[model samples]
Target chain A: MKKIVIITGVLTLTILVGYFFQHKNQRKLTLVEKSDFLQAFATEIGQLWRNADLEGDQLCKKALNVDDSYYQCHPDYFKCLIDKNLIDFRMKKKKVSLKISSSYKSIQRPTHIEYLFPLKVNGLYDLKLRLKDSCREVFLPQRYYPFLANQRDVTIEWDNFNKKVFVDRNLSRVWEVRQWATKVKNNIVLKKLKELPASDIAINLEIVEMQKYCSYQGKHILSAKVYDAMSLHPEDISSPEVKLFRAPYFPWSRKNTKTNIFKIQKKQDITLTEKQSENLCKRVYAKNCTSVPFQSYSSLSSTWMGARETLGGVMEYVTNTVHPKENIILSSKYYPWSSHVHRVGIRGYWDGEGRSMNNFDFGKYPIQVFPNSLDIGFRCMRFK
Target chain B: MIQVLLILFTFISCNQESWETSLQYDLSSINKVNFAKNYLNKGDLKNPPNTWLKLATFERVNKKKCLFYKTPYREKKGVLKIVESLAGKCSAFSKGRVYNDNFSAFRINYVSSTHAEKSNILEAIYSTGKEQLALDIPLINITSPKKYERYDNQLDFSLVPDVSFGEESNQLLLENGKVCHGVNSECQEVVGYKCDKCQNGVVEVVDYNCPQGGSKYCGPNKCGKKNQIACPRGYKILNTKLNSLCFEGSPAGFCEPGLRTYCNEKNILICL
Candidate 1:
């Protein structure tokens, strides 16, 4: 039998070359070795407002050195956990060793990378190809290290290939990364938006905070999206916490109820009357987010403001660079009645809910292009 | 070192696949005088230098029609030399003197061609490298690409998540007024300072917390902490802003702590 097909092709090429040299020499990043290169993501209080002078969890303890003191107990690095709302880290670990010269110096502070998978998860289907040939062996050497980490201004995002790991100026950077990006250290930009000359996309561009009028009727990433001034309720403010006003949408059924927009959150048209929206859906929590009662509009995710969906079965781009009119909006719009930063003057509350990852205009001076301000977006959804 | 091994062999021959969908030009000089009048003709070239022009782009080869040149290698002031060739042999890189020593990680240089009046010669070399690299070192990222993605894009250095690195003009050392142009480093705190009066976000220094406590006044652009209302005597703070709406901190009438929460159901006494 041809010696049983040459010993099953020499035991599948010696277990795929000894499982790629034992996960490239026994994986160094560990907690208990789960290797395929260890993937990770955690950092949203809105990505630490990308850097409008960082406040909340200070851009993830300065990009993941995590209040350094020498790896804060390094097994291989990454454990993090700041949590007041979120800063969680752990792309399974490995990459701490620094001293600067000796005494563990370390404070040059600036390292916020996240994704570093390099391959070797039992040969992902034992190298039988396809999974875009095992995602081009971790993004074809990251398309040549994100243009040598962008000629040193370093922003290396071959779409977080090898999962993620940007750690500027200490290590784990791409394209020579020495630190400097995020629109040059923290003007916090992502800009691309340009088109302007609307007859009526729904109309609204007040600027300091108002724009989001004609609901950019999407032809792609979800169309009928709306989100009203997120669960309004200032009712002419006095505060016991605005006496509690969560409810934005939900009707009948599991009943705890919450619905209010014209009756509060001041923009005015005045609609609530179902016993003044049930005396404010009996105070607090509220999450069904607008299905009519007084909602003249408030649909996109409803309140606490969030939603734009359809990153179609979620993300996949290592230069697929897909652009169904790419969205994720929210650059700045929460310091008015008080989330803080309105005239963009600045205090705290670092850009959360002000949303936008790029398009500039927080304290001005970035211009090359920035016309269209709010269309309200936020893509990427697949979790299944 | 031979332009760092020809830029590390043009970054490992940019992992092949015909340089992944070519077509990346940033030509400019009237697209190199209409690509030297369509592929080196109309007098095989000569009429480029306003300052300089040897620059090339717009390739074809095989269906035949070329001009890809971009070769310059002695690089390293912060690296950027690119060469990659798969027979499309990337070329065109010339200069006379304009090197910007870590001018925030420089690499794209070509100076010599100017004025034919705006077709955006890389936004006039990125506004002359942000008015000459905003006082040198440790902070240089301000790309300009756009006009059909500027020849495979140039003008995206990335990083501005709360801008820092100016222990004196955001360091690599070189301060004393740190050029304050592309600001951040010597980066005089502006991180989103909006207040021009009701445009609202102000902060050069306005320190916090007033959950009903007073006297704390930060400034440079404006800051407040208030809480000492004796005005029932002659009444001032401008007679409570000429008929109260209580615009200070404004949770709209805050004053909790002790005495069972003094006046908040809109009776508005907000005791300080």
Candidate 2:
């Protein structure tokens, strides 16, 4: 009886020890490993969210046998997703995995799985969630867990369902193809324009300046002064008695006398008002012609050589306006002699003056406009 | 006994899954010259791969065929002894081609049997020594024109006068009593000179011998009419206006000679 009891106790002890050892040896997932898995899961979810719309469109096309011309595809899109089970997703903590439904026969699974952890979805998290909401409405009709929304800030170990998730490379390929098509279209337009005969009007390539300063909207700009033909002749020097007086040469000569003539004389077009100047430019150039904006003018002046007398001189009229009755004007860095003086009872007022030219500041004070005063001028700009 | 067996089994499994085989290389056995030649022949210089070996050969030395490769890792302060010992083993066959006297170049052939072999070669080269070349090149000073300076006119300064009246109409006029009509005006005829209408209260007269042989003088009464008098002093009619009509497209205004005046907006003369 004593031997039997001792043997039974020993067997129980041995079993307890063996169980402890087995549990200790079996590797429980660490916090770091769980975090890594969550990161990869988030990345896969992001990719799936992004491709959901494209996938829906493709599926709708296949089901209805219609091209993009067909407008009513929303109902068909949802039906296609349901029919193909493309959005029938199962989420868990153990691993994130995806399998291309039989509908996507062209997409093949990658041989080597990339476990890119700590995926950077810094600024795109909200956008992805919004996309997921649209995708969720179609696939998951039931309410999703609230904790999933806050997963970025919190790490929770979900039920360990053994699965592997992968992002569909076809989604990325579709994106690349669309991007390439746009780039090719732009290149073709540029090539056609370049192949045409060069215009006599000096078109300066301000691509770098446009990209840096003008928000990449314009590639080329008119280099020669606007209303160049109306510029005063260098020989028409105004005496100090008529220094304040300004006017274009009589009958407006078409010859460009100001091209190589930079004298101390009053030059540049100062006769026309803003509306008149703009109309004149539009009439001559026809399209893509307008008064030079302060931004474009400042940028061009900053880089161009011989900008002072050619691009500057006089309070040049610009497109920017501060008041209803006033428009902004720019002057050359070298020549600040044209002061913005105003008289109260004049027909028009000089609204502002940019004396320094470098700071790009326009004065807000209204000044009188003399009938013969020709301190203000404007040049037109052409855009590409 | 059961617990001991479980622990051993667990350890063996973990070892099989996690253990990585280290790469090994015999430096002496590698033919440095042949490796370098093969690397260059593979067009690695033209199209380089993203690797430490390619990065090394990216910097081309001026006036020299050799390339300077810099190690990515920071050199330790006390590794000079080890560097010297390793550099002593660098073969003489790679002189001037792969390395100079100061720099020890390692030719890492990426087209080896396996990725492990390439990594092994990279590791071997890294263990040798870190060499740095200090360049004392002068900074290029570009003399850009002053931004605020007036733009120089392309016109020849020598040809331009300080002050010019620019083709005065009087300079083109013939001397008094000289025939003043038709081509060079060498004959006597009724000479007519347009009056300056802009001069408000001025008058002048010009006496000329006509083809009929008697002298006739035109005065202020003839202003704004046919056979108008010549402009008085300080007043002149623009040749442009003489050839066409009076200022502002009006033909009925006239004035004496040598009078300073201008046309008003109303086509009337305003004396300056």
Candidate 3:
């Protein structure tokens, strides 16, 4: 009787072990893993709810698609059932029963609102009502309206600037393109325009002035835009459209810019104090500079010259800085956007410590970066 | 196990992306830029006319802006103090071009700032006494110049004078004579210097700038030197004669009166 019982136990154990291995090989996500994903997604949605960017949709789609293939049949993650380049979404008020922890630790609520996404998990599709209303404002203060200057009816005043082109970047020479739009005979016309064939490509930038004894005027901002010419409306800017439109973009300075809104004339080495570099951001956005972090290397593309370094990760490049000098890199800590930092054995701080933990693989999705955080610095290049 | 998980979390959760590494360049399919017929074709993605770029290594201070660029010797140097008005369109344009790789040729045009705001039209600012057109270059070359020899960015256009001008009018009398008719007597005609090096060079003759009475320049190369030698008192200087006639005075030795003589056809003295 004992021998017969042992044989039966062995057969049952083998069957259970084989079943677990088959499920694991198929890359199925457990119920707990799915719950963790929803929790993290609720956090990103919190940020998306506040920031009013012209291209805010890109962020929403990026957060959902990042590290998870919504296509090609992956069993471990939820798949965005839709197959389109752009992900169009809007928040809904409908409620459904879900087991989700509150996103906001401050406010307690009975039911959370439904969040719609173009994703499918198992037999589920269309919408996910499993979110906590845990949204809170980060450093960015919500400006009601930012006044934008898109109207060309105002007279263009005098400004002196030479339209000259040189590739902008460190250790690389890249071409610049600017498409100037003008209203002629009540029709849109582009002049001296050269645009690349790509999807919504632009570099966020800001321009500030440093005079010997003067407070300069004029708009100091440009954001990524589409189908419209850049306009200048000076001061009194407080419209949501203006805030989105007036965000500074760096590539615009290098391209075919018509209006000379600001000019930086220096007869010597320009050194801005830490307070001044902070002010540079204030002048452009008209907001507290702390809202925007330094910069992100993930925004690059395959077009750049040093394709290897740009893709491999600039954090690695920053660690190996013999070119830009540590002080120039720390100019943001000072104002006038100048002032050099003497490297006396201080390499500064890292975002999340661990020198060897960076990933060199930049697949289809770009690495996410928050502009308002640390790793704040600028890059200077020698032209080819 | 807990310590291992903590280390992994720190390593994977890297944040703070940077713009210092974001590439700022345009990309085109790997094909040589088309410069057919030595002109920037409209569709050519590589090089186009009026492509302007400004690159500067910079630093800033209290109400002070400084810019640095490569010096003439190719060393980086700072030489600009940027003072600016509130941000707006940079309408004040100043277009200039170097003649060639030698950097020998230049045509600069400065748009009138005040007028640009009102006229909505950009016109070159030219004053009467200032240089409007350069001479020593051909009219055709200046009016419709050739592109730079080696570089394509060098634009080809004449320097627009600060003001616009109408076509040449025939109403003005030429030195050949306004009308050499019998009725027109002593018709004063204005003779203009036909500049051999025209267009890229200029020449203007103000009657006020000309010498009056007694001394006169006769050849293309005038005013050989300052003329200090003058006829003595009571003597008149006459230049129409083959040699200068210093009348009312003795000719150093002997000569006839009225049909005065000092030297003949071969520079030999003869009495008439």
The local lDDT score (0 to 100) that residue A33 gets in candidate 3 is 24
Identify the runs in model 2 with alpha carbons over 4 angstroms from their true place: A1-384, B2-6, B12-272
Question: Per-residue lDDT for B1-272 in model 1, tens only?
Answer: 33544554444444322110121111110111223323232221122211123333332212212333222223422212222233543433422122222222222232222221221222112122335321111111111212211011111122121211111112122122121112122223323321111111111211111211121111111011123211110111112333333333433222322211122332223334
- CAPRI band of model 1? incorrect
User: Candidate 1, residues A1-384: lDDT per residue as tens digits?
Assistant: 888767766675566556445334222223212111111121121132222223343333433212132222221222122222233333436331211111111122111111221222222311100000000000011011111111112221111111111100111111111121221332221121113211111112122111111011000111111111111212322322222323222211112223243224344455656665433322211221133221111122122212111111111111011111212221122211111111011111113243243533333222233345333322110000
Evaluate residue A43 in candidate 2 and report its C-alpha lDDT on the 0 to 100 scale.
40
Evaluated with lDDT, which candidate comes out highest?
2
TM for every model, in the order presented, reads: 0.20, 0.16, 0.16
Return the lDDT, model 1, position A276: 55
DockQ of each: 0.01, 0.01, 0.01
Q: Write the per-residue lDDT of candidate 3 for residues B72-180, one digit (tens) a residue.
A: 2223221111211123221112221111121111222212221212121111121123344221211110122222211111122322211111111122222211212
Report residue A41 deviation for candidate 3 (angstroms): 12
Which portion of correct inter-chain contacts appears in model 3?
A: 0.00
- Position B65, candidate 2: lDDT: 22
**Reference A-B contact fraction recovered by candidate 1:** 0.00
Q: How accurate is candidate 2 locally (lDDT)?
A: 0.24
Order the candidate numbers by lDDT, best to worst: 2, 1, 3
